[model samples]
Each structure stands twice: as structure tokens, then as C-alpha cells.
Target chain A: MTVTATAGQPAWTHSLFRSGWLDGSALNFFLEELNPAWSLVRPAVRIRQIIEETHDTRSFVFKPAWGFGRAIAGQHVGIGVDINGRRHERRYSISSAPARGLVTITVKREPNGKVSNHLHDRIKVGDRVFVSPPQGDFVLPSPAPQKLLLIAAGSGITPLMAQLRSLLSGRYSGSIVLLNYVRSQQDRIFGAALDELAERHPQLSVHWCLEKENAERFSASQLQQRVPDYAERFALLCGPAGFMQVVRQHWHEQTLDERLRFEYFGTPQPFKPDDKPAGVAAHIALARSGRSIVAEANQSALAALEAAGETPSYGCRMGICQSCRCRKVSGPVRNLLTGAVSHEPNEEIQLCISAAEDDLVLDY
Target chain B: MKKPHPSRALSPQEQDALAAELDALRDSVVADLGERDARYIRRIVRISRYSAVFGRIALMFGFVPLLWPLAVLALGVSKILENMEIGHNVMHGQYDWMNDPRLNSQTYEWDNVGTSDNWRKTHNFKHHTYTNILGLDDDLGYDITRITGAQRWNPGYLLQPAYNVVFALLFQWGVALQDMKLGRYVLGRRPLTEMFAKLRPIVRKSGFQLFKDYLFFPLLAGPNLLAVPIGNLIANGMRNVWTYSIIHCGHFPAGVRIYTRAECKNESRGHWYARQMNGSANIEGSRLLYILSGHLSHQIEHHLFPDIPAHRYPEMAPKVREICERYGQHYATGPFIRQFGSVIGKFFLYAVPNLQRRPRTA
Candidate 1:
């Protein structure tokens, strides 16, 4: 048997070379050369539409420059934008379902948050912003639970809304109870949409805990009265620290820890401050650069290094990622995540969360 | 007070303040790392690959006589882009934050015959750390051509003009040989055994490059093998000349300073910054030329921040120039042709050093 050129190789090889490697080489290069922001590695997404969700929160819909892979509901992606001349990145949950070709991220303007305020005030429909591929562990399982209870407060509704949208779209047999805690009727995010979905689907139920209107908080007793079968459901709790604390205590008291799930929206606050002197300026010697600068006790080594114009790699400034690991040559450094102080001579420390306790040397 | 070196116009205290400010500027840029730098490199890599592929395809069809030179030029430009913008910057750990194994500084190998390991040791550490310091920086004259008045004149330098041309033609091989310290081996400074051990990687890398360019790609053309290899040879030569010119223009410009070993000893950060500014020169060009030069057009900024991404150098140049002005130091920068002309002029000037003058100290 003789093999011709087409017959010699497998069909998959031709398709692979035609689409995967050789496929968009010229077009991708052209797009990248025109504007680097549109490169496939960090695709620029143009805001297609904007929805005002509440007083301070807004949902921005974006059309990615390249073909974006569908993200699992509840997953977050880091959005990057150049505010002034500097780039800032902040992770936000994808509030839109995969079936919706456009991606959506709901933003709640924090009082002093740089990226949040920038996105809310400066970003507009038709403007482009760079986005990373969706990432995060807080996602619904492939075979989702039959009895799902989603408890959210304020902007925490973003991810849960995604889950609700996804569940509603699918042939889900589960009953979902959304116990949303808001300041008042005006503060409820996706209120009209949630109401419409609840009216259409018998399995979906919506409950609002308006703190200002009721002048009462959602205590364990109140939650029990609202949803008696909450203990039987797989509960996903997402809210501020105080709200999470109350929910966590209730779960712990009932020994329902396994049924509870949660996601933190921001860097977890360091536990009660240790007796280490606060706001003391300590000398930081950069070994490679052969320079020394003072790092305040209250500020992270990364922050100090950055303020001094040193570029150290970092991602997720919450001490979870090891991108900012540097050799602590000497002196005391405190781990912000764990209130442990190390006076070791040479050890690697994460610059993002490690604060200087005294004079120190770092291999930068 | 008597003046030391003309470039050392600032007092120690002023130098220290300038260094602190520059360091702070670098930190601020680093702290703001985001999509821009990442996208810049990714796009460059894609364009480089596209250029290479396009050039190879055109070369393979070398039966058409007109396509030969164009293919060679394209391939040469592609190689230059890869070596300078992508390979050099990535190997300097500029994009080390990306954590991609292929783009990593520690492991990335350029398309050139010179191995990445040797370049890191010789260029990244030795050349960057020592800069233009005499007896330490081999790059001062590349250990062969005497481009500065600091080096002692020898009868061998009479043939330097001719040797400079030969070095330019085979620049990649010259760099590989320089990394091996071939002159040290010839003079018996290092033993033949150790020299050969170091030359192993260079030889292996050269062989791989030869096989790919001369044999493999040509053989793929079957009957058109001869034309393809010849085209590749011309392309390689083009790349050699381009790199040789750009590199020499950066360090061998007329007004650029050369330091003595004693002056650089126990050098403070501020002093080191001063040395880098004095020693390096920049090429004035358009964005296209800057990209082609791998932003080494801003050589002064590069020398100051060897590990920072080179794409940032253009933005940093003005700030650095301001700092130099503040310190009353010369910031050498000019058009490429003028810079290259100065390098060529200096190449001849130092051929036979006049005994009337002594080497100046910092």
C-alpha cells in the first residue's frame, strides 16, 4: 500500500498544525504589534455593556479580544488596567455564565481601594482592559449538590449570582435558597433578576435580610426560622468577616463544618497584633543592588521595596502566592500571615507579607 | 579642589542621593508590574517566530533568484530580534516573574552558537558587575581589539583594524570563543584541559547550529540544498554584523569612559551608578529601531538596571538623563550612525597608543 501526503499523516496532525501552531501566527502578530494589550497571553477586553446593580456596585460586560475559554461559575480572574502610568491588578469573580459569550465582573467601589474605584469611576463601555484567564478554586462541582443554600452579603452576591445563573441555565433538579443580607432594599444586587428567577422557577427561593429596614440582624435563630432545612443543604457562605464569623460559629455549633464552604474577597486581616513594635523604621539592605533603605515596621517589605523603586515579582499580595520570595540575609522579619518572628541568619521570606522588625538584608 | 575624572562631577554625598532616588524609581516601576511588560515580550516572541518561519519558507524556495537576498535579510533581522530583544532580556531575568521554563533566565538558550550558561557568567555577572573597569571587564576591548587608551599598546594591535573586520564577520563565534577565554589558553594563563572543558558547550552549540542551518534545513530542500545553505550563511553573516555594530556602538563610543580596577574597588551603589552612566552610550532611534536593538538603544539605562525588563529603558532614559544632569555628569547618546562612526574611529585611535599620555584614573 502506498501513502499519499494527506494519507501519510493522521487527520489530527493536519488540524493541529493548521489551527494550533500555524494558525493565527500572522494575525496574532499583527494584533500584538498594533497594541500589546490585545496579545493572547493577556487579552484586552472591550466593555460591551454596563449594568448599574446598586448605589456603589456596577456590572461591566466585556468582549475579549481573543477566543476566551469558558470559565467555571464562581471562578475569579485578575483584571489589569493602567491607571495613570502604573498598572494595577485586582481579582474579581465572573458574574456571567459561560454560555454568555461576553464576560462580566461586578465591582463594588471600596472606600480607599485603588483598582476598584478606578474600575467603577474611570472604566466605561467601549474602553479596553486586560484580563487573565479565569482562575480560582471557588467553583461549583460538575455534579452539583441537589440541596444548595447560598448565603451572601453586599458584594459577596457576585459569585453566588454566577452560580445561580449557571444552575438556572442547566437541567438542575436542585432546590436553591439564596439568603442575601443587604443594608436595605436599595443595596440589594441583582434584586429584580433574582425576583424574576424565583417567580419563574419553583425550585429557586430568594430571602432578603435588610438590616436597616428590619433593625434586626440575621442571627442563628432568625436564619433557622427563615430556612428550617438549611442544615440539610450544602451551604456556601460569602460575606464580610463579621458575617462569616457568625455563620461559621453557627455551623461549628451544629457540627456542620463539612457542609459549609466560603471564599474570601480580600486579604484576610492579620490576627490580633503581636507585641512587636509598630511603625518602627528598620534598615533594609538589598544585597544584589548593594543598597540600603529603611522599611517601616507597619509596611510589608514588598511595599517598602516597591516604594524604593525595586521590582520584585508578586501576585496575590495576600501571602498565598510565593512569587515575592526573597532571601532574608539577616535581622528579624515577621510573617504577617502567621505572627511568627524569625531572627534566622539566612532564610527565604515572602516580601509581600513579611514586615521588618529590625535592620535586615535581602537578596533582591 | 583638583578634578579627578570629568564624569565624576558629583561629590560622594550627591552621588549617594542620586543613587537612592534612582533605586526608588526602579522599585516603583517594579511594584507596578502588570500586563504591559508581559504582553510586550509575548508579542515580540510571536513576531520573531513568524519572521523566522516566513524567512525559512522563502529560503526553501530559493530557486527564484530574487527571493534569496530578501529571505536572508528577513532571517537575519529575525535572528537579531531573537538574540537582542527576547534572548538577552529574558536571560537577564527580566521576565523571570512569568515563571515559564522556556522564557526563564536560568535555562533559556538563544538561537546563537554561544551557550546561555557562559553568557550569563561572562555577560550578566562579570561584564555587568565589572562594566568598563580595566583588567576586569573583558568587554572593554573584548580581550583582543584595543578600543580605549587604558590598554597597553603591543605590536599585535597594528593589525587590529583587519582583526576588527574579521571579528565583526564571525561575531557570534568570537563571543563563544571569548567566553572560553581562548586568548588565556593561547597565552597559557589557563591550562588546555580546563579550556577544552569550557569549550565543550560552545563546540556542541556550534555543531547544533551548523546542523540546523547548513544541513537539516538545506537537506529538506532536496535538490535545492546548496542555495538554501548559502542563503543561511549570508543570513548568519548579516546577524553577526548587526549585533557587532550595535554592541560596539553601546560601549566603544568616543566619549565613553573606561574605569581602572582601583577606582571600582569597594564601589558604593551611587559610585557604581556613576560608573555605568559614564561607561555606556545610547543610540537615538525610532521605536522600530529601538525594538530591533532590543532597547539596548538606551544602553545607559540598561547598564544601570541590568535585571529590569529592557522594554522599560526608553521610558527610563529621560529620568536617568535628568539624574545625570543633576549630578553634572555626561549622558552619552547619539544617532546610531554617529555612535558607530565613533566606535570605528576609536578602533583606529587605540591601534598604536601614543606614549605621550598615560591612562586616566577615576
Candidate 2:
């Protein structure tokens, strides 16, 4: 049998061939035919319709021109737009019903966001966009959420809105709290529709939080205050980067099992903040001399340095991508993962994930 | 800096001692975490910082490293070019707590390890826990292989490396038979609900992701379309072969026992651990070896302390061995090259249930 038949093999894939295994032989047939190479799924979607969501937000309904589906909701697609000829991709949550033939994705223009801004301005009703099908583990289980809190800030509500619409249209008999956060009254998405849904359901409540006009910052405390007592209320929060950060800074900190859900608005770079190398404070203190040296755990070392006020040089942050890699002169740094430490006795470190463990001096 | 080996073993007493030690060694490992590690990191930071500053200068100077090479049809090692090590490590949950040291973030959950409900219970649990337990370890002819009485091989698969796409390109016909034949034989009578509920989602997405990873990127490797796929084909083929050799080398070796459930239960925990050691092969626990196999060389450490991060195994190994030695249990281990030979011997010893292999037709 060929690899095609056994295609869905587990992806613990690595060196399956040797230096000369595929050389000058019919086994080359198996090499190319059986082993997984690349190019399976991509976005390749055609926009079918558009719905005005808010002042800055809009829902773009798209259908795969080819075969797709077999994917779930909360799953995201990497939509590539050919703008100025450089193909740029932005991963967006599939805000549409999985049962529906076409998947819906709602995009809110980022004020200074590159792709988001380009998409909002240039993408049209009949545009064909390249996209990867639902690439995240963010979908809700079927049977609908029993008591759900669909949280959103800015346009982060797109996916949750999709979930909400799917659950409601499917005759879901559950209570849902839609915590909609916006800068002002002009920014709320699906506002009137939510209001009407809330009026009819009685169990569904729409908590609108517009920060500029709502006086108090619609914060975790306020969120906590709203859902004060519940043995089982699932929170699906989304929004602007800062807004989601704030929500995460506030939501269920003491637990990780079964209560919270996250649909981050950032690229999937393993959205982790805990992998900062040891002695971050010490380096911050050292780098702080005459320069603002705050450790941006979200960034590479060079990125953090630049953000901190140092002009630094770098390349690809991926190890093999060796663009932003540098020579380690001295000092110990802990690997963000596996928490292993490597000392100065080496060539260079990948600063993208490396953090200093002491008050130190860097080459640049 | 490097991945810890996956086959590190701990004596019974050391296993108990490790649990206690980890609880107490919190933050204390930093003291012994030497200057070499520190300097290596700082240098990387420095080089990275300088490279960024200077690369922009170079780009301004009209120095396009990759682009210029792409011009000459012989780009040196574009396979290494596309390999996303960061993505690999991040997927393994390595980067989650790299910053805060508090493990405050949740990493992308893979098939095995951790108690997170999200992990797809692929043959991972079966392959690792049961090793070569035939009729139980569905890993042999799982969702990947094409056995007898299975999906007929499609010639179009020669275009791409992964089997799924070859199958898809031919027709979505053969996958069911392949899955049925192996999945039927290896996936024993666990609760049907357990399979559907726990494993289905992971199996579903992973299958598609496999196609995407194998076919999607290669088909679009670069400006030259064929260059993209051909390059991917080479890289992916190499990666798969290495993975296959390392994997089968561990369990199929001679002297390893493939026990039934009754045999497994009757053995004491120590003996059971010994069974795992006996069943699996140990590669060298070198830094480089750990990396190539996702540190699975410390398979014993992996089995003993699945929850403890893989990096901690090297540090804990010597201590673990001391305890195992004291217990007088067979803590199986050997260099990787030696283990590889053993596995080849075992491969013949425990032949795959071949009645299911596809029939040869003229």
C-alpha cells in the first residue's frame, strides 16, 4: 500500500530516510510517495458575503473553493491576502457555524495593525483569500455550553459571537452572559441583535462595557462581580491584545481545569509569558542604567532590548532559522522550556527565547 | 540548552528520592546552574542583538543572504531553512514557563504526557505504556501503515512524501481500510466511548494536520513550485526515516517481552518498570541525542516521571541510577547504536501480525 492510504499517520515525524536511502532506486518511490512531505491544507477561500458588525468590525463569510470542513469551531484559519504582492497571513478564529457550509470570520480593523488594517480597507465582497482550515483547539464541545460567559473586547468577540449564534440557532437552552467591551457606544458589535436576543431569552444577558463612556474600566473585578456565584460557568474571553491580557490577568488564576477558555488575538507563538529566563529582574536592573530596561517576556531578547531602548541586531529567532541568533560571551541562561540551563561554554544562544539570569553586560 | 535524553532510568529508591528532591529543589537548581550555561545564553543574546542591528545594515547594503542564494537554483539546505525548531519546542510545551519560571502558562498539549483532558489519546498511550503488547499496542499498523487486506498503494504518492495526501490525491478510499485493518487489530477492547470521546478529536485534526504539514508547505516551498515540494520531499523523507529507526529500535529488540494484560498485572511495579526497560532500548543520553528524538532517549525517565519536565532528567539521572542499583532491579540501558542493533534483532523476534498485510496481485 502507498503512503496516501496511510496518510493520517501520527505526526511524531522526523528523520524517516537516510543520507542515501532515496538515492538511485525505486525506493525513491516510497520516499516521495509514502513519507509526508508538505502541502496538505491551505485557506483558499472565496468571500461570499459580508455583514457589518460594528464601527470597525465586520463579518466576512467565506466558503472553501475546494474540499474543507471536517474541522470544528473555535478553530482558526490563516487567511493570506495578496496585498502589494507580498502575501501576508493573519490567523482569524472561524466565527461561523461548523454545521453551516461556509465558515464565518469577523475581522475588526486594528488601529495600527498591518494585516488587519489592510484587510479592512482592501478586501472586498468577492475576493478570494488563501486560508488554512481551523488550526486551533479553541472550539466548544457540542451539546452547547450550559452556563456560558462569552467575553469580548474590541473585535475579539467575533469567534464567541459565532459560538453564540450557533448555540442559539440550534435551540440551546442555556444561560449566556455576553460581556461586550468596547471603547465607546459606537464600537459595540452585533449590538442591536444581542439586545433583542437578551430581551427574548431572559436567561441571556448582554453586559456592555464601553470604557471611555462607562466611567470604570470594564475589569476583571467587574467581571467577577457579575458572575459572582457559579459552580460551572465557562468563560470564553476574547478581544484586543491588551484587553485579552487584562482579562487573563484577572480571570481564573487558581485553576486550569474546565472553567476558562482563551481565544487569543495574537499569532500562535505558544503565547507563553512564563518562559522568561531566570534573573530577569537582575538584567532589567543592569540594562536599566540610563536606559529603560523592562523585560518584555513576550519578545525575543533583541526585541526586548530594542523595546527597552537599545539598538540591537538580530535575524530569524528560530534555532535553524538562525537569524536573530548571537554568540554567548558569558553568563548562564535557562531554557524557557524544559527549564534547562546552559552556561557560557557554548557558541551562541537564540535570544528570541533566552533570558539572562544575572546583572549582566551584553555585547550590543 | 539541549533536550535531555528520553531513556534515563531511575532505581526505585531514586524515584522516591526524586519526588522529594524536586519538591525541595525548587529555585535551588539555579545555584548549581553554572556560568557556562549563563555565558552561552548571554552570548546568544548579544549575537542576536548585534545581528539584528547589523543585518538591517547588511540588508540596507543590498546583502540578501537567502534571496541571492535562491537566484542560483542550488540553495544550500533549504530543508534546514524551513524547519521550525521554535515551533517544535513550543509544541512540546518547552517555552511556556521559560520566562516566569512559575509555569504560569499552559502549553499546547500534545498526545501523551500531562493530565490535561485536551491531549489526544492516540496510540501514544498504547505505544508507550504497552510498548510491543500486540493486540494492545495499535501503534504498529495504526492510522499510518498500509497492511495486507488494506488500502491499495497509490502511485501518485510519489509526488509528495506523506501517505495521506497520496491517498487523498488518489481518492479518499483507502484510508478506511488501512485504519480498519490496523485500528481493528491493535486497538483492543477498551470502552468504545473512551475511544470516541477521548481520542477521536485528536485523531481527526492530527490526520489533517499531517497532510498539511507534509503536503501543504512542500507544494509551496518557494517561488519554483517543484523546488518547494522536492525540497520538502527530501527533508521530510529524511526526518521520517530517522524517526522510524529510533522508534522501532526501542521496543522490537530481542529479550523484550510483549505481555498480555494478565501478564502485565501479575508483575510487581518494580518488575513492571523493569519490563518497560527491558522492552525499550536506550540510546546515548548525550545532549545531541536528546534533541534528535525530543529527548525520548530518557524513555525510562519519561515513563517514571512523565509529569516532570524532560530537561530535568539528565540532572536527575545519576542519582536515579544509584537508587535503581540499590534496588537490584534490571534498569535496562545501553548506548543508542548498541540499542539500535538489539531492536533490529527484536524486529524479527516479534513479527508484525502480518495476516492483515495487503495481498500481492499480478
Candidate 3:
């Protein structure tokens, strides 16, 4: 997000800040006490309402603070909250329409999720939260497709729900099919809203795949029976990794990958040391400091660096804060949180949650 | 010179037990850190920042007689709060767990002329790691004053009492210059080019401070230029002297110990804790005074757990004293005047020669 010097201030005030005679951060520091929502640069939002969508899920509606920019529906926004005395940030897809002045995010509490559980238990209406500008590539395609197939499972319905709300509220003339999967009736989110919309709009079709009711699992035959034009329509899929993996493989086998877009939900399970062979070590080289350290397969990069007498800045030790995020110049590293092996060069990784997969080079 | 009195020694087993107990205390406190700690620091930041803004705005109306002194006092309090309570503690990574970018140790820049980077190196790492170790800790005498009797007496030290006044008046500049190690440059050890390279960031940082207080803000006060700049100067001087006394009282009080490098080598965790307890003294005062001093009044607790939040020092202080009592370790503490008086006494007592010696070893 651009922090243009006090946007509505006099031209001279902008120049004053630009000239370094006045500091924007210092001004923001003073103003934050008066109103947590007020900031010179950073975007902040105040919780205005909360909606219980399910037994385990709730939707938070936020009013943007002054200087907070607009967020498009279907895009993800990073919401930061202080749990205990520490701040933790997590990204969630905006579940509200861009036309709405208030932004909403639907969150499902995960058993082991620090941020999700904190938001569900501790956050209240009128509390302030820091927000990142709207992000992610999961947004709806421009010049809306004539025939759209939307698939979601569990909490993955958030972004697709937003796309559906935005599209249905507007003058877009299109045939939309929404397939929502849940475990039981109580597990379904936005059930009433989706039903109301489907009844009001003739072009919209709502399909509920309740697993507890022994409904047929998603398959080629079932998809074909539900939507005869599914192969010809653009599809957006979001679900648990397992569900998406199956659907993705099916689409790839059919060479229909280009017609489908997908996003993953649910936490990636943490790495277990027992999975690795004992006595294996990864060599990590610091590019700037020219120091090399050896880390065991179970050791986080932060721990290894500290053991080598390097004082890298870190917070929470867990991957909650991005404070320890630094550039990985080369080689592979496994995210301890998800056990996902990342081979991308020159990408930023959190030192606290990353274990060297092999010989690695880092920009310290 | 008179050396510090040696205390009762502990067995290696006793030292290990001491380490475990202190470690337990630290862990318990850390586990309990939550909204209360975050709120305390945020309140301090709010008070410091608001005071600064209000003080500067008040200085703009410096033409009013009563507002001038009040503005200067406000600015002085603001500077003390920022430098001591907020800046010093945060730069020690005390509030880093909060994960607020503003409170981060690595990037926090205070209102002082000293750059945070320099302070982190010289103060946090060097001074803290070698609290009272001679030659190794730059803060032993700040490379200027003969703070402890461990140092050899010199004719130069005769003027230390006189220079100590000037040093207090310009403590921030003294701290900013500490990392430069200018003594080497003076003695023709460090090359002028190398010194200049190290001097660049300091000059840039202090230059901004100078311009802001003396020129920029004064210019903004169109009619009452003299009062604004003058008020700013006195405000800065107040902070310098106040911090100097607080720091000096903590480190250089009469009963504080000074260790030789040989004696401190390869020390264990508990041994290090013992050394810190011996080397630091605490000032007793009301809660407000502790806040104003940035909780440095509990210097013993701070030395033990530098990264722990300072406001937690009070609650931890009584427990720490109890531990010290059980262990038979001297936990030095007294009222502010008594502590400051002892520090002042050390200034004169350490300046002259005293033929006395004490044998010690690690």
C-alpha cells in the first residue's frame, strides 16, 4: 500500500514529511493512543459486528479506519491481532462485497490454530486490528464468464461466497452453479443466505453435498450429472488439500486444468522429526556475514543460527510473526509448520519455521 | 586503588542450583506475559510520544512566560521516558515479543542523538555481556571516567570529577561516541580514514537531532525564536543529566564490584548471574520514580534478565532479593539519594591512588 504523505493534508505538509523535518511514524505513534484506528501510513480496521455462521465458525465485519484502502471481494487480507502480549497475523479471504463499506472475513476455528482460536475467543466488537491491503490472485476473472462452476468444501467457501455475493448483487447476467460441501447441517456456513439468493435468482443453482447424509462424493459422474455443461464452464475450486488434490488430478487428467482455478484452505500439518533419517545435517551459509552453520533436520534455521552465536532478530519462536522473515538466496528449505519443501530461489522465508532441506544460502 | 570487597564464594553445585532457580523464575515470568505487559509498554509509548508533541507545540507558544518552563519540563520528561524506559529497554529486546514493529529492538530509533545501531552494539551486547569486566566492557568507565578502583590511578583521573559534570551534561553525545572508540584515534592507533568511516552515521543521526531541536522547531516559532531553541536545549540537558545519574548510580555505586577479565573468563550461567548481582546496585523509590527511571531502579533484576520487560522488574525484584538472601549473595539496594551519593563518592575516591590489593580468580 502506498503511504502518500497525509493524503488530504496541505501540499506543504507533504513536503515537510518528505523533507524529513517531520516523521510520519512519530506522528502515527502519537495519534495511535488517541484512536487505534488512526494512523499516518498503516491501514487499521475496527470490528463493527460479528456473525456466527456455524458452531465452529464466525464472520467478523470491520469498518476501515482513516487511510485504510478498499479491498476487493475474493482477495485475501492479513488480519493482525494481539494474543496475550504478542501480536500474531494470519491471512483470510474477504467474505464481503467490494461495494459494501464494511469488510467481513469468515473464520473457522482450528483446534491447533493460534490466530484462528484467538480471533474466535478473544476478539470483540470495537477492538482494532491491523489489516494489509487486499492481496492474493484468487479474485474473480474480469468480464464475468457466462457459465461459472464454483466448488467449495468446509471453510474454503469464504472467497467463493464473496464472488457469488458480488456477482449476484450486480447486473451480471450469467448462469452460476455453486457446490458446497459440509459434514452436517450444523457445519454449513451461510446456509440461509445462499438459500435466499438461490430462490431469488433463477440463474443461480445451489447444491449441498452433506457427507453425513451419505451423499455421493464429488466425482466425474456426479459432476457431469449435476451440471451437464461443467466441462465447458470456467471453474473455481477451494477446499481442503485432500479434496482439492483429487479434483485437481481429475481436471489435469482431462486436460481441463486451464479452465479451473483453485485455492487451498486448512493449516498444513507441522513437520515431525521422526520422518527424517537421524544424523543428517544441512549446511546453511549466510551470504552477507559469510558464516556457515550446520543444522540438524529437526532444527529450525533460527535455532541453528543462534547456536552458531548469530543474533538474528526473531519473535514468538513460532511462525506467527513475520519478524524473522529473510531472503533465501538458494537451495531448499522445509517450512516446519507445513513440512512443505520450498525450492524457490530468492524467496522470503521465516527463520523460526524453516529447516534447511539441503545446503542453503541465505541473505542475513 | 581500593578494590571491591570479595563476597562469600559458592560451590559449583550451589551455582548450578542457583542457575536452575533463576531459570525457573525467568520461565514462569515469560510464560505469564500477556495483555498486561503489552498494555504497560503501549501506555509508556503513548505518554512519551504525546508529551513530545505537546511539548513541541507548547514551545511554539513560548512567548507566554509560564508555558516556556512547562514546555521544557514536558520535553525533558518526554526525552527521559523515550530514552530510558522505552528506548533503552526496548533496544534490549525487552518488548520484541510484542511483535509491534514500533517496539522492535533492531529498528527502534529514539529521540536521543545516539543511533540505535551503535547503542545496541555498545550498550546491549558489550556493556551487558561484560557488566563490570575491566578493559572488556566499554562501560567500565565509558572509556573516560575512572568509575571503579580497579583501574590504575593516573594524573588525568584528577580532572575526572570536573569532566564528569561535562559528561553528564552531554551524556547522549558521550553514548553516541562510545562505539567510535575515539581513544584509539587520539592515540594514533586507528587511522583517520577508518575513524571517519565509523563517524558518518553518528554525524548524520546527531545532525538531524540538532536541526530538529535547534533550527527547525525554532524556525517554526516565527516570533519567539529564542525561547523555543533555548527551551529545547535545556530540555535535552535535563535528560542528559538525569540519565547520567540513573546509569551511574546503577553501575558505579560504592559497593558495586569490578572484575578483572581473567577472573570472568569461561564463567557458567550461574557465575554470570552472580557477577551481575555483584556489579549492579538498585535505587529504591516509588512506582512513579521507577517509571521515570525506566525501571532501572531495579538494576539487579535488569542485569539478570535484560530481555524481560522492565515493568516486570518490580514484581520480580522481591523474589530476586529472596533468592539472593537464601544463597547468601549480597543484593545491593537503597533509596535514590543514598545510591546517587555512593556514586558521587566513587567519583572522587577512585580518582586518586590507594595502595591496596585483593587477590581473586575465576
User: In lDDT terms, which candidate is top?
Assistant: 3
In candidate 3, how many Å is residue A207 off?
A: 2.5
Q: DockQ: which is higher, 2 or 3?
A: 3
- lDDT by residue (B1-362, candidate 3, tens digit) is 55446557878888888888887898788778889999999888888887988899999998777988889999999999999999999887788667666776656777888888778777776777778988888898888888765576789998888999999999999999988888889999979999999988888778889999999999999898898899999999999999999998888876788888887778777788898888999999999999999999999999988878999999999999999989888888899999999877878887886546644333
Give a tens-digit lDDT track for model 2, residues B96-157: 22321111112222211112222112222345455544455665334344322222344432
Query: Number of the top candidate by DockQ?
Result: 3
In what order do the candidates fall by lDDT, top score first?
A: 3, 1, 2
DockQ for candidate 2, C-alpha atoms: 0.01
All candidates' chain B TM-scores are: 0.95, 0.52, 0.97
Candidate 2's docking class is incorrect
Model 1 TM-score?
Answer: 0.68
Per-candidate TM equals 0.68, 0.36, 0.83
Using Cα atoms, each model's DockQ against the true complex is 0.16, 0.01, 0.31
lDDT per residue for candidate 1 within A1-364, as digits (tens), equals 0000001112332343233223333444466668755664456677889899889989989875544557888877667666544444567888887664678888888887767888888888888887766666677766999999999988888888989999998899899999999999899989999999999999999999899999658788898899999999999888787888888999999999999888766643223234335564677877677787768766899999989888887653644224466766556888774456876444556788899987777767
Winner by TM-score: 3
TM-score comparison, 2 vs 3, better candidate: 3
